[model samples]
Target: MTTFHDLRSRRRDLLDDLGELEDAFAEVTAALDEPSNDDEDARAEQRRHRAWLERQRAGLLVVLSETERALLEFGADGWDDP
Candidate 1:
């Protein structure tokens, strides 16, 4: 039974982490495919970051789902976007 503010804060943080992780993954891939690659550290780092991103994304999805459920319980109060 978390408040909307708490859920929103966590969701925002999680989304930001996912964005950073995605950037890291993309950077690693680009470097790995380059002809003059000098960084071998990114392979492992990419794997780790990708895993972390997946976990965070899943958790955030759950939090959003729960938030929607709570909102539903409060009754539909004209949610249609005008």
Candidate 2:
């Protein structure tokens, strides 16, 4: 069984990781929005990267959601103000 402190730490880490992922996702999206060459291969590669990033972001979101729910159930343990 994980301690409340451990869960709090995990939640903080997950939130930080999610923020970084979101930043990266935004950058990739911006790159995709820019005009590019007509080469189908290059376009396909960019699309693949975008898709992969989207999947990563989705997975991180799910984990973050789970972590938050667990933390909520565990209570704030005086770590937070009511």
Candidate 3:
């Protein structure tokens, strides 16, 4: 029995999560750009981490899109008490 309130809450949470992930992604990209004395193994680990973050970001974006669509479909008049 999901309500409009629930959808809105989920959307807000997703947006926050996306923002944090974006910041982390930027930091990782900057780290990758800079010259470091890290060993091959360490660099590889960083690349892997970046890739994982990218995948997570993509998934979150998809969920966020879906949530937005649901909100639109529900409309403002569809508010149901949680």
Q: Which candidate leads in TM-score?
A: 3
Q: Give the Cα RMSD of candidate 2.
A: 2.6
Comparing 1 and 3 on lDDT, the stronger one = 3
Q: Scored by CA lDDT, what does every candidate get?
A: 0.61, 0.77, 0.87
What C-alpha lDDT, on a 0 to 100 scale, does residue 54 get in candidate 1? 68
TM-score to native of every candidate shown: 0.53, 0.79, 0.88
- State the RMSD for candidate 3: 3.5
Q: Which stretches of candidate 2 lie above 4 Å from their native place?
A: 76-82
Q: Please rank every candidate by TM-score, starting with the best.
A: 3, 2, 1
> lDDT per residue, candidate 2, 1-82, as tens digits?
8776776787788778878878887887787788976588877887888788788879988987877677778775663322
Q: Each prediction's Cα RMSD?
A: 4.2, 2.6, 3.5
TM-score of structure candidate 1: 0.53
The model with the greatest lDDT is: 3
**Clashes in each model (backbone N, CA, C under 3 Å)?**
0, 0, 0
**Residue 16: error of model 2 in Å?**
1.4
lDDT of 1: 0.61
Put down candidate 1 lDDT per residue, 1-82, tens digits, no spaces. 7665554565566566667757765775666566654455656676576677667667767765776566556556632222
Deviating ranges (above 4 Å) for candidate 1: 1-38, 79-82
Backbone clash total for model 2 is 0
